[model samples]
Target: MAKNKNGSGFSRRKFLKGVGVGTGALSAGLLSPAETLSHAGGALAFGTPQGPGAVPITLHINGQAHRLSVEPRVTLLDALRMDLEITGAKRVCDRGTCGACSMLLDGKVIYGCSMLAIDAQGHEITTVEGLSHNGRPHPLMTAFVAHDGQQCGFCTPGFIVASKAFLDRTPHPTREQVNHGLGGNLCRCGTYHGIREAVLDVGNPTGKAKTGGQAHGAL
Candidate 1:
């Protein structure tokens, strides 16, 4: 037992040597701060590390379930169009500002480009391809065609999906409301007039009147 100058049992040199030995043990992987802390806190097991490769994701699209292996960084738009072959959601501005990649996530409108594919799993995703059923077109689709709402058609699918979401929520919206609701989608053909008319047409459709066995369009 070494004695210090002040009569302490342990000398400063002994304390320094113990510190050096502890540091050497720590550097050599014999002692880990994390393990020591975890033991002190009564934690027994360390979590398993994530495996390599893409993660398994389950996407509910258009009422159908699709299992895919996608990277953590894959965008929802890419997953829908490229991997899943559901090209209804267009990729115009890869960024979220364009809204051309708009789709229904759990019945709510969201920009697919902005959302991660992994995050969209387990949510009901509706694309333009899933809008029509049993060969019958959706009301908005019919209205779009009837009113010539689409011109270039590059942005048609996105507009139709976005419009469907809006009209489903508000069947009879005013012009201001329609404009505000559809503010997310952009059309390069500048066919806003027809789009507005189409939305209104669906909201208020004139029925034929029967008089004396003759059919006449209702006023």
Candidate 2:
């Protein structure tokens, strides 16, 4: 509250009006939160309420940097699949309950749908598509195919990414450990048995990879 020429402070009604104006500006995209406010007549100054529209953001994913334009509300999953065309992270149960949208942020498992694209700026993002080597499939991916870990494919990508992160932490996991490690993801197809087996086989240095050729389809 500022004193006017008469040395009077702002009334409650005037303070509320200023707050409303600031809030409206944010939602309507007229001014970003980072934008500085200007003073006019010792009162809250509001710009023309035009939507902020899409803003440019850069994301580092899969050993590459991508520049794109998106609204602040866009989730990392939407930005990956819809904007950048990097669809390895599947979107299911977008509320972060199901791990279907799992991806790696700095080698740690995360739900892409639960994080904003604007907030994923600095992390090293790795989707399922990024798991493979130069020309060969990632060992975990190969293990999934060998064990028939995926069916219907909606949850495969998440499982693969999560499994990768889990194994990175627990390289030699028991069957029970593998089960607990993948507790966050779900497979409606009830392929938990094969999924756990895949993780176990990948963790086992002496276990032979199965002669399975079924491909993990696109996310």
Instruction: Write down the lDDT of every candidate, Cα atoms only.
Output: 0.72, 0.75
Q: How many residue pairs clash in each candidate?
A: 0, 1
Which ten contiguous residues of candidate 1 have the minimum total lDDT? 207-216
lDDT of 1 at 194: 84
Which residues of candidate 1, in runs, are more than 4 Å off?
Answer: 1-52, 207-219
CA lDDT, candidate 2, residue 37 = 25
Off by over 4 Å in 2: 1-52, 208-219
Model 2 C-alpha lDDT versus the unseen true structure: 0.75
Error of 2 at 208 (Å): 11
Model 2 residue 125 distance off true place after TM-score fit, in angstroms: 0.3
Which digits, one per residue and each the tens of the lDDT, describe model 2 over residues 48-104? 432257655667899987766667788999888766667778888999978999999
Estimate the lDDT of model 1. 0.72
Best by lDDT: 2
TM-score of 2: 0.71
Candidate 1 versus the native: TM-score?
Answer: 0.70
